[model samples]
Each structure stands twice: as structure tokens, then as C-alpha cells.
Target chain A: MSRIVLEGISKIFGSKQVEGVELIRQGKRKAEIAAACGAVVGLCDISFDIVEGEILTLMGLSGSGKSTLLRCMNRLVEPSCGRIMVGDVDVTRLGRKDLLAFRQKTFGMVFQHFALLPNRTILSNVGFGLELKNVPAARWNEAAMQAIELVGLKGWEAKYPHELSGGMQQRAGLARALAADAEVLLMDEAFSALDPLIRRDMQSELRDLQQKLKKTIVFVSHDLDEAVALGGRIVLMKDGEVVQIGQPEEIVARPATEYVARFVEHIDRAAVMRAGQVADRSAPVLQPTLTVAEARIRIAGEGGDAWLVADDDRRFVGCLLAARLAAARPSETVASLLEASGEAVAAESRLDALLARVAAEGCVAVVDPDGRLIGGVGSRDVVRALAAHSAESQAGDHPETSILQQTAGAERWTGASRNFPSTRSATKASTGSPTMALG
Target chain B: MLTTALVAVPPWVFIGLAALATYRIGGRKIGLLTLFGLLFLWNLRLWQATVETLVLVSLSTITALVIGIPVGIWFALSRRAWRTFSPILDMMQTLPSFVYLIPALPFFGLGAVSACFATIVFSVPPVIRLTALGIRNVPTELVEASDAFGGSTTQKLFKVQLPLALPTIMAGVNQTMMLALSMVVIAAMIGAGGLGRAVWQSIQRLEAGAGFEAGIGIVILAVILDRSTQALAARARPHGAA
Candidate 1:
């Protein structure tokens, strides 16, 4: 029920919205729409779901409308045309009173500047949302204390906002949102104001807090590395439109637009690329049942220190060193001479974590969640994955079609767009899947 | 009736209350000023007239604030309202202060009523202008935070805007009080009796010493009022406390 689905959300900012909205519906870009209607285009035909209990990053450069899109979810910035469905409720259709009540029950928001009330003590600031909800003072205070302790600011509750450092003030801001206990947390660049070191601390602590809390969080950021550190799907926006939406690794691996590719070009590829994604599928795998002579014949020309041996079912059996295979008598089975197994790294593990093993062993098996042998990630493959920071642009992809298809329940007719062969094939892997999962 | 009830109370009681209030809110120095300023006025035999002026200013400042603040808030919230009201406020400020008395005399005949009416008209613009300015000056992100949390309009005003705007509103209140005091002599042109009447009578009789004494009495009262309100506004700010 926490799934927030935005369908064809478009926001045009200015009194000339009727003309701007019509121009947008006619497939006008932001600049052209502004030129034609004299209204700044805020968001254009955005459709996506904020998956429950996961941090979905709205990532883009400044002025890309990521913050505006986040605000639209709670109707803080109303969309000119669209339907916003939060759980079963249509947030766009709700009246003023109903929307206020529903927002109180559903969303807790944090800001980039740590918007703590300067007049109130930390306890009162943390309990502000509850106070707005008309919660009893004693109850709100107790609940606020719990949130303050959760954020590690228990002893600082009596202090004013200005007395605390920037980092501590942000912790109090996060505690304020948590005290509301709403299901979704909308954090708009919540750490952008802090100095770099403190910003890093807040990012990791927010990730840890999200793990313990399990609240659905929609975080807006212009930093690619911060989005990757959050370990969630990225909805990369551009010029008031969603350019691409995928996991950090997937966006880095196969960016859907030239702008997105450029934005992610400088991101640390080793940290963003996953083990399964970087695995060398071209590596020859020998079966454990194969005779030693048969294995030698199968691996005659392939030059490597070891070969990953798997059973017939593709479950990884063990690594068979080249020396052992060469020294073995023709009568010995491949399984009898194999090294210990269970050395496979999970598919979801980032490539950086697998680098040490790959460098030490010269070969490491990458397995799926089921422990099935996917492929091996070797030193060369790791280097290739890191160096290949996707300079190739996804220029001809129909991003709008792919995004609509990816986020289902947007049954509106988007017309026939079969010309984009790359988009059609690229979207096929996650078609109808609930989320744009991490690779 | 209310003015008589207030005046019949012993002057020492008012003096003591003012001292305690200033001490608690404005600290020791302003508190001592309050005690001695009243004593000095009593020693000059100007205590009764000073009390009458204090009552008139208090009544008018409250009346002006009650009317001005809501109008300011409405103007700030609506661009069209601001567009319409901004010019009127400009006119109000630029118009001769004596013009307000011209209208007040026709509506409310001589004595305290006309004096109170003229002072209210003269003092209300700053309250309205500063109230709107304070609210508008609230940071955008803070307002957005409140809106995102689903705060009702009333809740946002009281909890966020009003509390943050306290210092600015207090400055406006101080200005209103000062403006009210400046009107005292002019208000004495009518039948209103107070420190203003003392100064005006001394001027008519050509008694320069009496006029100077009454003028010093008003100045002492002004200092006491300004320092106390300023301290009250300062205490409301937690940021400065740090």
C-alpha cells in the first residue's frame, strides 16, 4: 500500500499553464514550451512508482525538477496534469482538508538546509510534526525522545538549533521526520548543505537508519556517488523529464540517454558495477563429470590459471587449477581433483568487493542468488568493467516509452513506439517486474 | 471607566510592576531606569499627566495591533491584495500626520476619543508593514518544510511564522509606542489632558522651564518603553541566545 504511483505527471509553473500544458502534451521540450507559452516547465510526463520500504533516489543536476517531482508526490507542488496514487488514495484528487490529513498520515519530509525551528528547543522541533497533528504533548514528547535517541541526539534535546553544529542540526531534522512516523520519508537533498566529511557521515547514517526503520524514502540528489551509496534505484531526471530510471549500476552500465551517460561518466565504476554485471560469461566452464582427458581436450587452447567447474545443473562445484588438470592421469575424474567449492560471490555484490579475491586467485566465480554458476569475474574483466565507463550514448532510445512500460499500472495509451529497437530490447529484461532492481 | 479604574490605583503600584517586569525581561539596568524614571516624574509633579498619556498610548497601540496584523497577513498571502494595499499603505505613511487628526475630529469629538483615534491611525501602518515583511522574510525552505509536513494554515502561522516573526513585530510595536508618544502634544490641542497638556499649557503661558520639564518627562517614559520592549523581543530569539 505504500507504493506511490505517479502517472503522466506534468507540472508547468506560471499563469500561462493552459498553453504550456497543451504544448507539453504536443511533445514539446522544455525550452520550446517556454518559448511558446512563456511558462517554465517544471516536470514533463513523469511516471514512476516509489517502491515501498526502499530508498528511490531522484537523481539529476540542479534545475532538473527532481525536487519538484518529489514535492508533487505529496502535492507540495501540484502537477498541472496527472494522477498521483499513494497506496489506494488519489493524492491529486484529495481536497484541501483531506489532502492535509492524508499528508499528515503518510509523508514526513526533510530539507537540505536543516529547517529546524530556530525559536524552539530540539525536543519541540523534533515534535513539531506531531504537534501539527494535534497529538497530546506528553505523547509527542515521549515519541520525539525515541526518535532523537534513534538519531543519537538524546542528550541534546534541550538545546536550541543554533547551539548545535550543522551535522547535529540535520540529525535533529531527521529525528523530526521520524517522530511523525509516517510511512514515507521525502528528503530533498537532506545533506547538501553540510561540509563534505559531515555530508558523507550523514549519507551513511541515513542508509543505516533506513535499514533499521524500513520506511519508504524518496531522496533527491544531484550527486551520482550519493545516489550509488544509497544502494537503490535511481530515477535520473533531465529538463523536467525522466531521462532514465534504473539501479545505479544499470544506469552506469547502460545509460538510456547521452545526458545520463555524461552525468554518470565520472562515477566510480568499480563501486557502481555489480559482480554479476561484470562477470566474464565468455569463460569456458568444465563439468565435474568430465574425464580428465575430455577436460584437457575441452580446455586445450584456453589459457588461464584455473577453470570454474560446475555440475550438470550449473551449480558451481569448484575451481580446477590448470596444473592439477594437466598433472592428473587420464583415468581420474575432474571432480576427484577439484579444490574446495562455495567460493562464489553473490550476483548482487559490488565489483569492488570482488576485486581482492579476483586479484588473489586470478579467477572468482560469480553466482546468482540461487548459487548457480553465472560466470567468472577475473582481474582482466574487473579492469574492463571499471575502465569501460560507457562513452557510447543511448541516443536513439525512446525514454518515455521505456519508463512507462517499466512502471506498470500506467495503462494510458502512449502510442506505438516500436521504432526504438534498443529501448524495446533493453526494457525487456525488467518488463512487468515490480521494481527497477539493482543489477 | 477603564482609564479611571487604572488611574485610581496608586502610582507606586504601577512603578513596582514596571520595575519587576523590566527586571525580569530586560535585566537590572532597564528595571532601575523604570523605577527612577517614574520617581523623577512624580518628583516633578507630572505623575498624573504621565499616567493619562500612558493609558492613551496603551489603548491605542493595542487597538492598532488588533486591526493591523491580520490585514498584513492577508496582504502577504495574496499578491492581488498586496498590489491593492501597498499603495494605500504608502499613502498612509506619506500623508501629513495632522491629516489623520482632521478625520478623527469629525468621527469622534474632542478629548481622549479623538486623541486615541488619531494616534491609532498614525501608528497602525508600521505594524501592518512590518508584520507582512517579517512573515514574507521567513526562509522558503522552512515554509516548505511546514507545508510538506501537512501543517494547516493556522498551525503554520502560529507555530512557524508568528514565533519567528516575533522580533520584527516587537520592533513594530516599539515604533508604534514611539509614534503614539510623539502625538501626545498634538493630541493636547483637543480637550485631552496628560503630559501633552502640561507642555502645551506651559508653551501658551510662556513658561519655558515648565515646558522643558514636561518634555524631559516624555523622554524618560520613551526610554523605559523602548528598552523593555526591545529586551522582550531579544529574549524570544533562541538563535541569539546561543
Candidate 2:
């Protein structure tokens, strides 16, 4: 299902390409290689597969080679050594003429500065790629007009790029890329030039468009927030190398390197972490069929104010509170004692939104899409979720208060923030019971 | 050829057409200036000499543009070519115009052909230099955008770089035209007859008054051509731009 696969890609920008590449293979770092042969290392042994119909962001600050890596996908910046495979074709091996034709058909690109041609009208600029393919004028214009309308520039088709405002110019740039109907979109800092408010709007709109169009996108960005806002797997890079690649939450939760941990240190943990990530999947659960006599014995080993109950099929039935169980008749079915307050938070719900619910209910059932009970999130779980971050360790004596202070005005973090389906922290020691103890 | 054909059109008709052309291109002020300017030339009996000079300048400029533009494009797109060919341009510009004329006299003989050959050699450098500058000055990001969408080299030139460079290229054309006009008097020494010939003949007879009259006629023509081309370049700028 991968649209593009890049393997052993290393680009050395200098006249001494062969020597620089050999140095790279021999494990010389960027500065060493550059000093030895006067070659600037642009990318060093980059390998990743772009999944079909997903946005993958290449993120790093300036000089990280993120932009160079994006350009290398379509061969705008050719790698000194690499194998590039796009849908079964070896893109690097293609002849010059064939590469041009393939590039024409396979990729639609947008630029950071809205690089629309100054002389052409929006309509003409949008249709430039089609014109290159010798697509007939009437057909290309129709396609272009459709794209213009799609990007909400319907009435401004006749205006030149200079006539449009910065945001509008960016929309026209997006329209131009969309008009090509190319299978993959490689956007290089496409919206970094826009103001923050407009950038957020463009990010959400692009996310929506990508879903609707189902085009695979590889977006390059220097901003971590932008990468998070785009809601894709982030490829964190530094010094011409990938430091880590994962969903935003996974990255924030478990950074592979000190560098990566530093990058995620300032990120709002509550805003990025999902309920599933904080869910106590190892917690013991009682079956609804169990009587009060049977549930009491089962709950003896587990320490909780309440226990989530599920049917045999693992469908979430409800939770049995200790107070409710204490008042129940011995022979009564556990199902009859199930509390009305029990509500399951979906596994995909952001942890920030469920803070009050978990506080009010003591605990809540975390369920999968089909209402299958996966685990539980309690007051402890919410506090633990917030406390697990590296930031908390730096918070000293009042870490909890410092973390809570951010939630007071965290409205900005809630802007169409996409959540990565958080993974269960199975590696942590069981605070409840062994896995699948849902008996 | 065009100068010879205009000889039969009569002075009044030529004046009327030129006035109309300036009016269409530069508006009322320039139209009026052309009207009075040519009338003054007629009154001075320098009209015939003026026409010959206009035709010669026009021919030399057109030829320089036709030959220089592609070379300029080649230089802009390839640095290796620019490095190799730029010295030739520098030499062409610095070499005394008469030095080339001495070498050219054998090939073109004398009269208008020799004059035209010298005028072109002296004038082509500006167009070539400016055309290369115009094309090269197109923002790198814009060119990258075109290439990102898979524009071929020729497609990028005609569609993106060429249109953006038009205003600059037109300015080059104006420079070439100006250079061509300045070469006319020098060309007169080779037997090409025009306002230049009048100036030359006046110089030979020590007639300072007639030489000044011919010089004034050339000045008027320079102003007219300069203003006309400036108007054209302004119009060539991309629409909706200030």
C-alpha cells in the first residue's frame, strides 16, 4: 500500500560526490564528511515508505535537509546515492525524458511562497501542468476552473497572482496542484509564509481536501505545531538524519532520543495524548453475569473505587462502584447493580476533553468503535497522563499545578487538533492486573 | 528597402502616418511633439535625411534583437556557455566601432550594407546582456514552482520566464534602439546617406550651422523613439500591476 519507497538515500552536495558518499557509508557524520571532502551533507542514508492515502510530514529546523528530502522524492534535488521507487517504477533509474513525463503525471507540488507564475491568470496557472502534458485547452481550462472553485477562488480565475492577497495566492497555488490530479502531492513549506490564523485554516482545509481526494501527500515543515495540526505521522529530522518517526502522541509519549524528547518537551501533553494512551488496559474487570458474591471476590485483589463490567463478547456493559456493590443483595446479578453513571469514552477522544468526566464519574470505560471495553481511565490515569511527560519532572514540587495552569487557557490547542489513535502503554508495569483479566 | 519605398509616399503622407502612430502609442502630448517635430524637419528641408536615418536605425535594431535574444537565453540557462561567451560580448562592446568597420569593408563593401553591419555590431551587446539579465532575474522560487509541476525547459521559458522577463527585455530593446540611432552619424562616413550624411557633408564644408540643424533632427528622433518604447514597455508589464 506504499505509494513511494525511498531506500539508502544520501545526497552529498559537492563536486566530490563519490568520496563524500563513501565517507557517509563509512559512518562519517555531516561535519566530518564536509571537512574531509568539502561536501555538505544534505541527506544521509534516508529510508522510509510513504503509505498510500496518508500525509507524512518531514519536519526539522533549517539546515536539517527536510526540504532537500522532499525535493529528492520527485528528483528536483537528485540524491548522490539512492533507490527511489514510486508505485513499482524506479524513479531514479528513469531516463531524462521519461523522468519528465513521469514527474508531469505523478506529482503535484505547492511551494512556501505561493510560486504562481506572475504573467498567467489563476486559471492559466492552475492548468500549467496539464498544458505541459499537452492536454487540450478547453479540457484543461475546465479542469482548472473546477480546481479554482474547489479552493474557493471561483470568481477570481481571471486575476493574475500579484492581484491576489497572500492567502488567496496560496489557495491558487493549492488549486494549481489540485488541477493536475496527480496521484501524490509533495508540498514544501506550502503554508509557512501565511499568518498563523490563515495557516490553521489552510491546514484544516488541506486535511479535509486530502481525505476527500484521497491523494497521498508528503508535506515538509519546520514547525512542529504545523506538523501536529496537519495530523500526520511526523518524520522528525536533524543534522541531515531522521531522529524518529511516529504518530504525534506516540512521539510525545516515548521519544527515542534526547533530541526528540527536547523537541516534544514544550508540547501540551493533554492536548496531544488520547484516552486510549492513558487507559489502564491491564486493569481487572468483572463480568455482568457475576453475582455480587462472585464480583466481590473478583474485586478483592484490584484496588479501585469502581470496576468496569463487560459482557462475554467484551462489549462494555457498565461499571460496578464499590458503594453500589456494598449496598447490593448478595444473590443479585452484577448486571442489575451496574451504575447508570457509567459511560464509555471512545479510544480516540483527546485526554483534555475527558478530564471533567473522569473527575465526576471517578472512572470511565474506554471503548473501541464497536463498544468493546478496552480499559479504564480514572482520576489517577488523567493525573498520570499529565504527569508522565518530561516537563513534569522539571516542574519540581508543584508540577501538577503548573500542568493544570496550562489547561485554563488551552483554547488554542483545541483548533481542529487531530488525535493519533493512541497506543496502549503495554510496556508499563501493570497497576491493575494481567492483560485480558476481563473475567 | 523600406526607406526607398517611402520616398514615393510624399512628405505630407509620411508626416500624417507618423503623427497617427505616435498618437496611438504615446498619447496626445507625444503626438503633438511628433507632429511639430517632423514639420520643423520639413521646414528645414531635412525630412528626407530623417527618414533614411529612421529606416536604418529600425533595421539595425530589429536585426540585433533577432540575433541577440536566443544567445542571451542560452547564456542565462547555462553558466558554462555564459562564461565562455561573455568575453566575446565584452570585446564587441569595447572594440572601437571603426575597427570592426575596417574589417567589415571587404565583406560588405560600402554604403548602407556596410553602415548597417557596423551599426549592428556596435548595438547588439546591450540587447544580449539585458535579455540574459531579465531571464536570470526571474525569482528562483518561481522557476522551481514551474519545474515542480514538471515544466520542460522550453515550456518553462515560454510560459514562466519569458513573460515575466518581457518588461526587462523591452527595456533591452529600447537600449538597442538608442545604440542604433547613435551609430548613424559614424556610419555616414562609409557612404550611407541619411541625416548622418548631412552632418558629414556639413563637417567637410565647415558649415557649423547645417551640422547643428542635422544634430537637432537626430535629437528630435531620439526623443520620439525613446518615449514610444517607454510607453510600449509600460504596457508590456503584467496586468493589474502598479
Candidate 3:
């Protein structure tokens, strides 16, 4: 179910007046001075749904209205037009009292600046949100302490924001959001200000937290990599409008427009595509009585150099020797070559895992439910997939899936393991598929 | 020299104590520098006179701060009141100290009260400015964060703004106190006892030794007060101590 929804939202500023009007000459249009400031369409016709217990990312360059859209979600900056629904409530139409209550109970936000009170200790800062909500002092502190511990800042509660490093301060900000216990978390460039190493660590930590807490999150970022890594779906924005929205792989494979294509142009595709995308499904199956020479011919005909020797029940017994296929006699199963083997990966495994497996095994094979070889993939294929995904992602031809989808798909591929061969030529031919490769 | 010692010792003792307290609050460098300044005053033979000057300055500074901080906080909290009083504050800051004596002498009859009144007026600006600046500079994001969490205006001000503003406010207090000290010495011209009186007496007799002794004493007191207050300010900061 969608936990939050924004429909046909638009924000226009200074809509009425042109430039170079003197205040006296402008007269009462001066009272409409806001209208004279020139129209800035901060967000135009933006619409999306954030599913319950999912991480949705808004991705855009600076001035693209990603942050503005996030702000409008909570009425931090009121939208000129739109209906924003948090559950059954039309948040855009909320009165001041209702808005305040909604902000306290329904949403929590984290900013890029860490937004911690410089004067307060880490504990106090963390508890600040709860305190505002009128939680009793005792209860607030307890909740704050738990949040601090969650962020790995157990012993540093008494320290002030200035005493901590930038990363620690951001953690405190996260703790503050956690303490609030709101249903939805809104993060605006929260990790963008951190050093690269710290940002990566925080991203993993946030993922772990999300796994455990299952809170709905809407994160905003300009970096495509970040969005792909942490978001379940991505909404790409440009010049106050949504350019595309989709799973990371879909976007990478087929960007919605040229603008999106430019954004994804530099991304590595291998990191974004699943092993299933490039895995060959036509590996040869060996019979129990097949000779090594016969097996070799069968394997070659199937476009594979290896054959799986499985028993009648389809239990993977061993691999077949292609060179000795002709000498093998009947009743002599290929299971003789079934020495201890490395682990096989599912076809759906992400490219990152696939790469790791290839690195560990020098080659990886994709296997089905019965342990039958579906395809083989190597390091080179992973790289190729990444490149192809990036090229397609920039084109922005695919708009069905939001940017959140692309991010989530990218993350899955980068984190899972699978087997496939390096099909550079095939990848080139499939220019439409987006590759999200982590370089 | 003996008379100089008598006058200088009391103020130096208090000044040293204040400096030490400030050092404990601020840091060691300020403490050491304050001690060095006291030593320089002793070398000038004005340590005793300076000590006497310190007592009046301290009293006046305390009085000003007591009145100034609350007023500053009130002004910060209320736009209407601040607008009403802003011009008054401006006038107070711009008015000459000597002008205060014309009215103060007749009302208070030329004594410690008169001197203190003049010193208070002179020292109020730093306290007010610092307090306002500190509160204003408190991060808007933090304020918003607190509000989002459910904090009331009182909680936001006390928990977020005031505490953060302490360091800057303390700095203002330090400046005010220093300014007060200088004013107290000037106030001594109007029968305000202390180092300023001693300097005045020596000048009347054309006794360079007595004047120098009193001047040195005042310098020592200044060093002690300055260091200690700075130390206190530093120590009160959220980052350094906690």
C-alpha cells in the first residue's frame, strides 16, 4: 500500500509581475510584490507514491526541485497547488494545528547539516524531537537513549555536537529522527555532506536499520549512485518536473529522456544488472552413460564449454569431461569429475555478488532450483553489463518504473551473486537494457 | 611603596582569584596571561591602587550584568518591546559618561553610587549585544528540529537557543566587565574611593611615585579580572567542558 502520495503538485512563485517595475509605479501590484519576483516553478505537476515500509528516493541535480518536493511533502514549504495524502489525510490541506500534529506524529526529517543543537549534549539533541511532541521528560530521555545506542553513539551522549566529528554529528541527527518514532522519514541530502568513506558506512548502516525497523523512508539526493544504493525506487527530477521514475536497472537500461541519459552516462552497468540479465540458459546436460568426447560435442553445440552431469533425479552429481566424452562408456556417469566445487549463484543475483563470485572462483555458473546450469558469467561480463546499463540509464527511455525502482534494482544487482559469461558483444547489441556497474 | 602595597594587595588578591576562576572556565593560556599582566602591574608600582580600583569595577559590572541580561533576553523574545526600547538602547550607548555625572552627582551626591551608576551605563552595551547575538546565531535548523519533535517555544529557547548562546554571551559579559573596570577608575575623579582616588591624590601633590604606584595597581587588577572572566567563559562553552 502507498503510505504517502503526492498528486499533481505545483509550486509557482512571483507569477504576476514582470521585471523593472518601480515600487511607486507598481502600486498595489507592489502588495502583490511576491508576484513580481518572477515565477519560479519549484515543482510542477509532480506525482508519486511512497509504499509502506519502503525506501523511495528523489534524485535530481541542484535546482531540479528534489529538495523542494521533499519540503512540500511536509508543508515545510507550502505547495502552490496539490493534494498530498499521508494515509487518508490530505496533508496539503491541513490547518496549522493539524499540520503541526501531523509533522510530530507522521514525519521525521534529517538534513545535510546534521541540524543538531550545538548547545545541547548528544542525548539532549536526540531527545529534542520527543520533547517537542510533549513526551514526558523521562520518556523522552529513554527514547533518545535508545536511538543514540541504535546509531552506535552509546558512550557519547553527554558530548555536544561540536565535540564530535562530522560523521558523529550526522549520526546524532539520525538518532534524533529515530527517537521521534515517526512513521515516515524524510532525508534531504543527509549523507551528502559527509566524507566518502563515512557516507558509505552510513548508507549500509541505514540499510541495516531499515531492514530491522521497516519504516517508510523518502530520501533525496543528487548523486545517482547514492540513490541506486539506498533507494527501493527512484524518482528522477529535472527543472521542477519528474524526468523519469523506475527501478535502478530499468532506468539505467532505458532512461526516460536525454536529460536522464546524461545523468546515467557515466554509471557502470555491470553493478546494476542481475546475473539473470546476461546469464546463458543453454548449457548442455550430460546423460549418465555419455562419453567425455560426446559430452564435449554436446557442450560445444549448446554454446558452453562445460556440461553438468546430474543423476536421473536431477541432483547435481558432478561435471562432465568434454575431452574424454568419446571414451566414456554406458552406465559410467559424468559424476566422476564431481570433485569439490565452489558455490553457484542464482540467475537473479546482482552483478556485485556475481563479480565477487567470479573473482573467487575465476568463473561462476548460474544455476536453477534443481542445481542445473542455467548460464555462466565472468568478471568481464559484469563490467560490460555495468557499462551497458549506464548508457541506457542516461537515455531515460523507460519511465514506467520510478527512480526508486532503478535504485533498488541497482542495489540488488550490486549486492547479489550470480554466474554469467562476459558477453561484451551481446551487451553492445542490447543497447536498451540499462547497466548499473559500480566502478 | 608601602602605601602602594596596602592599596594594591586587596584588589590584586580579588583580581587573581577572578582570573583563576576564569582560567578554570576558559583555559590555561588565559590564566597565565592574566597572571603575567598582574606581574607587570606590580613592576610599575601601581598594584595597590589597581586593587582598590578593581573592587568598584567589579561591583559596577555585577550590577550592570544583573540588569542587562534579563533585559536583553526580553528584548530578544519580543519584537514589539525590542522596537520600543531599541532607540533607548542606542541612546544609552551613545551618551557620554561625563554627561551622566551632571545628573548623577546631584541625585547621588558624588560618591560610590554615582560612580557605579555611570559605570553601569557604560558597560551595558556589550552584555545586551552579546546576548542578542548569541540567541540569534543559534541554528535555525536546530530550532526547526526541536519544533518538529514537539517542543514548545519555552523549551526551544531554553534547551536550544540559550544554552548555545552561552559562550557568546559570556564573551560579551567579559567585555562589559573590562569596560566597567576602566570606567571605575575614571569615576574615582568624583570622590569614588579606590585606585583612581589614589592617582588623583598623587597628581594633586605632583608625586609621580604615588601616581605610578596607583596606575600599576589598576593594571594588575585589570589583568586578573580579564583573565579569570575569559577562563570562565571558555569553560562554560558546551564543546570544551562537556
Candidate 4:
């Protein structure tokens, strides 16, 4: 179930909000509404759901209302008009006292700056929420110590905020939120201020922490790489409206608009696309017990230099090279001709990690956790995916694609597709019955 | 009562108490130097007068801080209250110390209490202004964080805002004590006896050597009070509860 849902949320920064809201309902864009009523639209009818225990990233360039939208969740920056439901409660209608309690119990917030009280020690800062509620010192201190240990600052709890490095300070900030044990965490550009290497470390640490804690986290970031690193669904915003909402792979593969296409122009597809997504599921699956003569007939109409051979249970045995199969005895089993050169990777492995394997082996098989083959990722399939991604991003000026093009060996890979020998080319022509007849 | 003690107490006892306090606050070197300076004042025959000035300055600074800190806190927490009271504080600060003494004489008559009253009026502004500035200058982000964490208005004020603002407020207290010390000589014009009376007597009889002795005695008292309070304020610096 969706843990938090925002409906028709709109925030106008200036007066004439009534008129501004009316124009927004009439489908006026931010600038048009601003010109018409002299009220700046901060969020224009923004709506989305935050599923429970998912790290949903609200991503955009600065001034795109991503942070504003995040604040709207806890009503820190109240939405001008909307219905916000966390569980069954209508958060928009919560009174000051009730809202304060609800926010304290439900939402934990981490900011761009660490925001640790400079006067307080790390332990006190972490336990600040509990101390606010007048919890006994023993209980709050115990909770604070646990959180500090969780963030790897166990001994530093007695130190001042200024004594720690920027990264450690942010860890303390995160520990402060964790100490409260809130069901949801709203992290607003939490790692953006850190040095790049530390920023990456924090991202991974957050990812690991979220997995263990299972907190419904809404992360806000301007960097797409950070969003992808968090490995969550992303809601891309532009000009106070959601542009597209999907996983990084879906968004990169099929951007919903030109604005979104431009936003993802420099995204490293290898990092976002998983091995499963890149695997060619249409490839013929050969049975291990099938005769070499029968396997030759099965792949004769296909365009692969080799076929992934799997048993009846779809357990991947190995690959059978076409040349090796052709040289074998007619009565020999396909398993007997199987080549050990092919690599098998977990389906969840990222495409960047699979690229080196792809370069080494002509094709790599993608398997589930149980080691059952899902499909194969060949050089042609990778080249095709890269070409499509580059073409989409090429609508804008993407200078970074030169690196990908070089690494992909664009000419050799693309030429391999066009000038492939006909003997191994079958699926492109005899698509229907021939391959199925052998099966 | 403090005046009676100053008159009855022996010179060595006063120096001994001061040295102990200075040792606690400013550490050994400063404490010994202050004791040496006090011994010089005793040799100059100004110990009684110096103690009287110390009593007056100490009493007035404590009173000013007690009154000024709360008023500053009230101003910091409420914009409306600040707007209303800021101009009055401005007027109190701008009006000369002698002008305050003119009104103070009729109200309290010529005495130590009247001198304390006038000196407080003269020195209270720095504490109030600085305390308000400290609270007001607390980072908005920390306040928002406190609020987000469910801290009530009172909780935030005491636990987060005030604690964070202490160093800045202590700086104000230091300023207030210095200002109070400066007002002591002027305060003596209204028959408030202390080092000021000793200086006043020398000026009247055209006694240059006595005047110089009393002047140096006041400087010595000022140094002790100034250095001790400054040391206290420095010690009070918020070091993350460490």
C-alpha cells in the first residue's frame, strides 16, 4: 500500500493565490500563471504516492520545487491546497498540536546542512527529539547511543559538531533522525554538501541503512547519479510539476518528454540498466539432452554465433558454439558440445559491471538467484541498447557519449551487426515456424 | 552592608579573597599578578577605597545582568515586544550617565543604592543588546530542525536556542561589567564613596601624588574585575557539553 499520498498539491509563493490557483486549474504553466496573476507558483498541482519502505527520490535541478515538494509532505512548507494522507490521516487538516505530534512520530527529516546544534554534544543532538518530549535521560541516551553506533560514531558522541568532519556531521544528523525511530524519513539533499567521494559513501551507507531499517524514505536530489545510486524509483520534476516517474532504466530508456530527455542526457546508462533488462529474452533456449543434429536445426534460423543451452528446468548448462556444434557428430548430445567460454551473471548485476564480461565473452548469460538462466546479453544486444540511448540523448548536445562510443567499439560492433555471415543469421528471417518446429 | 565589610575588613584578607577568586577563574599566573597589583594598592594606602569600588561595581553588574538578560530574552522571542521596547532601551543607552543621576537622586536619594541604580542604568544596554543579538542570530536551520524534531516553543528556546546563544550572551555580560566599572567614578559625584571619593578628595586639596595614587588604585581594581569576569565568560564558552 502507498504509505503517503499527495493529491492536487499546489503552492503559490505570492498573493492573489485564489486567482493563481484558478489559473493553475485551467492548466496554465508556472510562467503563464505568474504573468496572469503576479503570483509565483511554487508547486503546480503536484501529486504522487510514496510506497512504503521504498527510497523514492524526488529529483530535479535547483528551483524546480523538488525540495518544496519534499517539505510539503510533512507540511513544513504547507501546500497552498491539497490532500495529504499518511496512512488514513489527512495531514493537510491536522491542527498545530496534532500535526506536531504526527510529524514527530511519523517523519524524520535530514537536511542539506547537518544542522547539529553547535552547543550540544553529538549524543545530545541525536537524542534531541526524545529530549523534546521530556523522555527520561536514561532512555533517550540509550536510543541516541544506538543511533550513533548505527552511524559509526560510537565514541565520538561526546564530541562537538565542529570537531567532526563534514561527512561525520551529516552522519550525526542522520543518526538524530534514526534515534526518533520515525516510520518515514525525508532527506533533502542530505549528502550534496559533502566531498564527492564521501558523498558516494553516504549514498551507499544510506542505501544499506534503508534496507536494514525498512524506513519509507523520500530522498530529494539534483544529481541523477545520486538518485541512481540510491537504487530507487525517481519522480523527475521540472518547473513545479512531475515530468516523469519511473525506475532509472525506464526513465533513461523511454523519457516521457523532451524536457525529461534533456534531463537524462548525460546519465550513464550502464549504471542504471541491470543485466536482466539488457538480456535478450527472445533468444532460443536449447535443451541439454537435445542431439547436436537437432540443436543445429533449432539455431539454424537464428542470428546468434552461439546459443545458451539450458536443461528442462531452465537451469543453464552452458553455451554451444555454432562452429563447434557444426563440427560435432550428428548423434552427439548438445551438452557434449557445450563451450565453457560463456559467462553467467546474476540478473540484478548492473550493466556497467557486465560490460567487461561482455567484452571478454561474446555473450554473457543472465541468471536468477537460483542460477536458472533468464536470457543472454550479446555484443549486438549491448550495442543496440547503447545506440538507442545515445540517439535519445543525442537530441541534445551530449559530449560525454564519445567516451561510451569509444568503449563500445562503435564501428566494429555496429559493422558486426550489418555484415554478419548468413549461416548464423536465421531468427531475423525464419522467425515463426522453423525455430519453433525444432523446439 | 558591603560598604561596612570593606571598611572593617583588613587589606591582606581582601587581597587573599581576590587572589583565590582570580586563581579559580584566570588561573595561577593571572591570580598571582592580580595579588601583586593588590599589594601595591595596599602599600599606596588605597585598599579600603578599592574594596568599596569593587563592592559597588560587583553589586551593580549582578543586578544589571539579572534584569537585562530576561528582558533581552523576551525581546528576542517576541518581535512585537522588541519593536515596542527597543526605542526605550535606545533612549536609556543614549542618555548620559549624569542625566540618569539627576533623576536617580530625587528617586533614591544620595547613597550606595542610588549609585548602583544609576550605574545599572548606564551599563545594562550592552547585556540587553548583546543577549538579544545572540538569540536572534541563532541559525534558522537549527530552529527548523528543532521544530521538525517536535520541540515545543519553550523547549527550543531553552534547550536549543539559549544554549547555542550562551557564548554570545556571555560576551555581552563582559561588556556590561566593563561599562559598570567605567560608571563607578561618575557615580561617586553623588556622595557614593569608593575609589571615586579618594580621587575626589585629592582633586579638591591639589594633592597630585595622592591623586596619582588613587588613580592607579582605580586602574588596578578595574584590571582585576575586568580580567576575572573575562576569564569567567571564557570558561562559560559552550564546548558541546565537554
lDDT against the true structure, per candidate, is 0.82, 0.83, 0.70, 0.82
Docking class of 1: medium
Report how large a share of the reference interface contacts model 1 reproduces. Answer: 0.76
Off by over 4 Å in 2: A280-314, A317-343, A352-365, A375-383, A390-439, B240-242
Per-model TM against the reference: 0.88, 0.86, 0.72, 0.87
TM-score of the A-chain for all models: 0.84, 0.81, 0.78, 0.84
Model 4 chain A, TM-score vs. native: 0.84
Clashing pairs in 1: none
Error of 1 at B84 (Å): 1.5
- What candidate 1 gets wrong by more than 4 Å, as runs, is A286-313, A317-342, A390-439, B1-8, B240-242
lDDT of 3 by residue, A104-142 (tens): 888889998998876578998898788777789999999
Q: Write the per-residue lDDT of candidate 3 for residues B58-166, one digit (tens) a residue.
A: 7788888899888878877787877898888788778877777777788898787888888888889889878877887777776667666655568778888888888
Query: Which candidate ranks first by lDDT, i.e. highest?
Result: 2
Tell me the DockQ of each model, to 2 decimals: 0.60, 0.64, 0.35, 0.47
Off by over 4 Å in 4: A14-26, A293-305, A311-316, A326-331, A339-348, A367-374, A397-439, B240-242
> Residue B234 deviation, candidate 2, in Å?
1.6
Candidate 3 Cα errors over 4 Å, as ranges: A8-37, A75-81, A92-101, A117-121, A131-141, A154-169, A280-302, A306-348, A356-439, B1-59, B70-95, B102-114, B185-213, B240-242
RMSD of 3: 9.2
Query: Residue B167 of candidate 4: its Cα lDDT?
Result: 75
